[model samples]
Target: MEISRKNRRLIHTIVFLVLPLTAFILFVGFPLYWIFITAFKPESEISSRNVSYWPREFTFANFGEAWKNAGFSIYFKNSLVMTLIGIVLILVVSIMTGYVLARYKFKGKSIVYLILLCTQFIPGAMLLTPMFIMFSRFHLLNNVVALALINTTFQIPFNSILMSGFISGIDYGIEEAAQIDGCSRVGAIVRVILPLLKPGMVTVAAYGFIACWNEFLFAFMFTTKQASYTLSVGLKSLIGEYAMNYGQLAAGAVMAVIPVTILFINMQKHLIAGIGAGAVKG
Candidate 1:
């Protein structure tokens, strides 16, 4: 009877938890595994009918080809610059906006919140034409700065709400203490509040980086110049109308995944903390 009961419990655990988790892992991990393996495979093997689970021949040639021949070098640089600039702009604007919403009581505060909330529901595609016209009028077409700015604009609404949650989670007494110690409002924020906000800021930055790095439509439509193409656009360009280089395409994808992967791995702890704190208080 004891052994039978133990067996039933084990079965229940497997069915309820282990099996589901394993399935989820396989579902998410298989594509990434395939991409990694395909990236190393030679072109001949890649296009071959034989479905090998592993690469028949490993080579770095694909990465080299993608970087040099496919112009991923330029794309990589542009993505890095644009993502960094966009993150900075996002952090600044989100922090300030968040602080105001969290700490201040002002006229039209509810309306402002409603407007910010509504902006989140607006699709980026809807604004593309008008944005294109505006950028054209401003002579900012094919510009990395302009790309960063647009990305920042799209990202700020949610980030501001998130930032407000984080700011609200922080104790007001801390800022008051800083002020009592001869720190002005700006100085208190600069020295005390900002340092305390690091985890939240990191969370915001990670979100901004991912959004800016993966943005395809804006980067594609706004920049016609090959020299101005970002990694997302550059990857799209690899799809030749008639024939595509699967090997180089896979290689470019792997390259694009690296920075964001590293970032999440490093910032995972802070991300979880920030999210938990925000959820509790927001």
Candidate 2:
């Protein structure tokens, strides 16, 4: 009788979870599965009326062709360059700005922070026209640097806010002690404060990296040169009017997702912890 009750409870739990699980598979999982299947299949299989979840044959040729033909080589390099520049800009600026906001108190500080936070409420799409005009004036319209700059600018608010919380959570006692020991204020921060903020740094760096990597709107609008194009733009052009080669497009997308997947796999632990650190510390 006890065993029967336990089995029934287990069944109830499974039934309750299964609906959402099935929904996820039908929606998110099925599409991703199709992308994977299509990436490996030949063009003939894709055009056939009968579509199966599994591929009849597999080939790496599609990936090789996509890699070479899609101009992703140029896009890949541009993306890397943009990602690095954007990350550096975000980290340096956000760290300094966050430290100031968290450590110092002065007149108008609250108002300043409020203003900064309010900027986040503005729709990014609304600013697109203004940004385009500004970049055009500066002759930055077709450059990867323009994309990196725009992405970093947009990302700064949230990074600074997160860092403020992280900085506040840290006790100032350690920095004070170091300063009392004959270290300068700058030295104390460098030696004592920044080291303890690794988790927050890691989190923000990951955010900056991912934002720059996959950003499409600004990248598409800003860069027109094939040499300057980011991966997202390059991938879209793969599906031209004359040919809707789903296999090659899927293969290109798979290639695009690989770097981000590897990055998350490596840093997911710290990313999760760092998210809570900011909220709890401040």
Candidate 3:
């Protein structure tokens, strides 16, 4: 009877969960798997009607060719530099702003909060024209600094919200206790409150990193100089106006996806805990 009950529960669980699991496998898992396979396939096999579930013909040369021929090395370096710089700036600015919002009672605090929330309603595309003109006038186009600055601006409001929620969850008495122990206000934040904010910080950092990493429209619009091209822009070039090289395109796509995947995998536990904590506290 116990075994039958356990089997019945299992069947009900599968009935509810299996459809979503199957959809995820088909849409998310299979695409990643196909990219991995395609990254190693030859040019002919990639374009051919005969699709091998696994590569009947495999070549490491696709990656080598992509690395050398697609200008990915330079693109990868530019992407890394821009993403890192943007994330650092966003984190520093948002953390301080979030802390202030969470802890301080000031005039117009409600107005400030409302303004921050309202900014989220604006589409990123709406800022493009004004930003482009501003950057162009300043001759900042085609620079990684331009990309970093633009991305940071958009990231700050959202990140500040996430951080503020997390900061609010921590008791103000903690900072008060630290102050009583000879910590200055800044010192209390840096030495005590900041330490407690780590999980939320990690969560925001991952968000900022992925946002900058996969960002294309701004990168494409802002960067025209060959040296400034990020992986997304470089990947676009793999598809000519007329002809697309499927193999190299797939290889570049895989390259772009791999780093982010590995990063998430390594930080999976921290990310989950951080998100969960932030959500609960918020």
Best by lDDT: 1
lDDT tens readout by residue for model 2, 1-282: 256988888888788887778887799878778888899999888889998679898878788877777677778898999999999999988888889889999899988778777777788788898999999899998787778888888888878978777788899999999999999988988899899988778889998999899998888888878878888988877766477778778898988898998889899986777557544432
Off by over 4 Å in 3: 1-16, 269-282
The TM-scores, one per candidate, come to 0.93, 0.90, 0.88
lDDT values of the candidates?
0.91, 0.84, 0.86
Give the clash count for each candidate: 0, 1, 0
Point out the higher-scoring one by TM-score: 2 or 3: 2
Clashes of 1: 0
CA shift at 160, candidate 3, in angstroms?
0.5
* lDDT of each residue in 1-282, candidate 1, tens digit only: 356988999999999999999999999999999999999999999999997799878899999999998899999999999999999999999999999999999999999888887786789999999999999999999899999999999888778888988888899999999999999999998888899898789899998998899999999999899899999999898885468999999999999999988988998886666557544433
Q: Give residue 270's lDDT in candidate 2 (0 to 100).
A: 68
Residue-level lDDT for 179 in candidate 1 = 98
Considering summed lDDT, which 10 consecutive residues are worst modelled in model 2? Answer: 273-282
CA deviation > 4 Å runs, candidate 1: 1-3, 272-282
